[model samples]
Target: MSSAPALADDCRFDDRAGLLAMSPEAFDNGPDEGWDALAERAGCQLEIAELFTAYRQQAKAAGHAGLAWHEATMRADAGQRDPAIALMRLTYKPHGADPEGWNHYVDATIAFLDDDLPALKRARARLAKLPMPLGNAREQGDDERPAGRPQLKIVDALIRCMYQPYALASESCPEP
Candidate 1:
């Protein structure tokens, strides 16, 4: 059996200190800065991946499944889909509650594939166990629960930005 990865020495900041030092602006900041810093400080992508893996493991062991899911999603969005999907599948059973969320997850995943219709269709069919959200509610509004989470909306926007295709400019380059 394969062992889980280890956290990088440099990326192993004390949670208490990090939280105490975190600014309001930092919360709104993109992960690129921090993730890049981690990669540079650790001196390798393997170490950075290990650090995130350890963090996810700790979150899962602590029963903070939502946090684990969030981390997994972030990693996936950053191009680590296999591990991310594995972690997500572990956190919540496929076809369990929150079908809408699962469908979105599958759709986002298929969007990342290299336009393989057979694979895409298979994934869509497998994810059919989950219901799609009505009228893109996942993107348009915040989830109105006691939790009041905005992460879902953020994920939707990220997926759209990441996977949606764009047209190329014409060679003539004439202004429309």
Candidate 2:
């Protein structure tokens, strides 16, 4: 069996302490490669994956999609097949007919996990085609991206992390 990839000393996704010390913007602006490296590093921590799964079960029981998604991501980082498939399905399962921008986001996430560069690009283009938030209003320090667009930022961060490794490092934050 293949072993997990080695991580640099500064990679913050290795444990709760590092994760806590990190800022949210890191995931937003950090190098795409860093996200990838984190995921690769996660593969070596099966114990952490199990904990994530337990947390996912709790989140699901509480009907918290956001928390479930986060835990699912941790599981996915450990190369858990169920979480990867479930993550895509959960994102795609909601919203029938006109899926708004979710289709792009879901597609982008799947492509990222699959390492399909072309598909990821196409999905990102589709997402970009959607109207961006109006005006350059002052940024809020809140956890969410904005109203009516829950989890978009998280999805983008996950996508960036899944595809590349060891890019210019930036800040990140705990999932709110």
Say which candidate scores most in lDDT.
Answer: 2
lDDT (tens digit, per residue) of candidate 1 on 28-48? 233643333343342243444
Q: Per-residue alpha-carbon lDDT of model 2 for 122-170, expressed as tens digits?
A: 7777776675454313244444434434435645555555544312101
lDDT of each: 0.42, 0.48
Clashing pairs in 1: none
Task: State TM-scores per candidate.
Answer: 0.37, 0.47
What TM-score would candidate 1 get against the native? 0.37
Could you give me the TM-score of model 2 versus the true structure? 0.47
| Candidate 2 local Cα displacement, residue 74, angstroms | 1.3
